[model samples]
Target: MKLAWLRSLESAHQDCVWACTWVPATDRSGGLLLTGSLDETVKLWNPEDLSVVRTNTGHCLGVVSVAAHPSGRIAASASMDSFIRVFDVESNNTIATLEAPPSEVWQMQFDPRGTTLAVAGGSSASVKLWDTAEWKLVSTLSIPRPEGAKPSDKGSSKKFVLSVAWSPSGRQLACGSMDGSISVFDVQRAKFLHHLEGHTMPVRSLAYSPLDPRVLVSGSDDECIHMYDAEGKTLFSSMSGHSSWVLSVDVSPDGAAIASGSSDRTVRLWDPKMRAAVQTMTNHTDQVWGVKFEAVGGGARGSLLASVSDDKSISLYNYS
Candidate 1:
């Protein structure tokens, strides 16, 4: 299998595009592409022609993450300023604005059921979950501090969270931190389960396999991609090829393959069964920041992959 380049938008964003997601097709509209950039704007695009449908401007700092509700009627975007704006997709009207003081926001995701939002709480050393109905701070799944640490180290910087992922069942949440620790939490009980460890540097991105909730994939600044059995708390395999930090990673819709983008300026496709990188695409000039698989209603769109980078562009590919 290979990634066939379909098209690319040069300067899709005025500055670095940090995050991207597909707003699933609802009765009112088809699947649309949502992207957040260092330009401080969130832009929605048509999948057919790559034309801008809307440009949302409110974030004062670079938007760090964007997540769409499963129903596609609502979406949320978070910026470096620790604010999350939950808005209506078609009307562009604000549903709610959420912020946890002193806790910087990084990656965010709506639960598969769309009833809760899980946010990576940087510096706060926790995963913040907000309920959708009332948009209230429902739970804080804080990462446990290291053993033997001093009492003075409360809110320790070593565990600052940078990425999070909800299992397909929505019963569990995993968060990656600055200290290369990934914490697993039981969502139902709001309990900390365990940590999966290996990478020595920060882990910046994570995803759970759609086919198996226990299978998790992560990319780290240590230049490695790891597959883990999250429930068993074990690392299955580690693939290394990128010469720099592996910035982003995602499992394909079928859960048979993994795709990753890295600071090494390349996008790679890896086969979990082979435990090796099968293909690499040199499509960006600078560091690649985000890589995502379009998970719209199965047959409406082909297997598609989107990658954003420090090069200020977006590239779409056919994952066949």
Candidate 2:
């Protein structure tokens, strides 16, 4: 494994950077990096030098999630205000605004085919799907209440969804919740299939391995990263080393390793099989909130990892 510091941007935002995703390359542009933050802005960055390309502002509260469309020309962001904003990537024009009352929004993703946008509905214990073309509410995949549960019990909020991911094949959806439960859904049927169990704290971030639809990874406040066999319904491995809450985790595009940012103020590179942190980056002075590997193609080899922290900084690294 090889790593090199690329660039660091001080004051990337006034607060925590909550989410990051790689925008696929397009004819009119090279690839871009999209990030959402507690500053209430979704920013587009030129990946080459990590320069600010544009800042899309509209969300009334902290922007918690940002996802790029598979086509690269569109993106969506959701805020704590329970609203999802779909926008044009190049022009920064709002395409549509979606909401589900009594439910807060956390993480979101655009389907691999770009046909739908999935938003994790916090408190509502469901995932909301929006039609990409018509920009209309498409479906609500709700987690069924546990057996013998009371309607007024606070346990309902335990299903507060916090993160969502789409498999590379676009056939499935997996969402992590505050209660540490992960729900897998059948996208074609818009149905909640089953739950994956492991963590006991809030699961803040999750991702599916690009090479295997059955493999899923998650980061949680429990300071552990979990590897699950989604199809097998079994926990494959658990990685623990971060001194604080693990805020986010992302698999390299090649699926060779995993990268994670944590409240421990460090970014870690892990070997999935070893289930141990192979490297630690301690350049950030505060809690690290987001980490992602740049997508494949775009004239780039190896991989690029971007990390944002409570230190109000963004740091880029070259992974080889």
Q: Once superposed on the true structure, which residue ranges of model 2 sit more than 4 Å away at CA?
A: 146-155, 298-300
Indicate the residue-level lDDT of 308 in model 1: 92
Q: Model 2: per-residue lDDT, tens digit, 1-320?
A: 65588889988888788778888889998889998988989999997787899998888888888889989999888887778888999999998888756437777888889998888888888888888999888898987654443787545567788889998899999999887888888989987778888898999999899888899999999999999999888998999999889999999877879999999999999999778989999999998888989866643557799898888788989988
Pairs that collide in candidate 2 are none
Residue 7, model 2, lDDT:
88
| Error at 164, model 2, angstroms | 0.7
77: Cα error in model 1, Å:
0.5
What lDDT score goes with residue 258 in model 2? Answer: 91
lDDT (C-alpha, whole model) for all candidates:
0.91, 0.86
lDDT of 2 at 239: 95
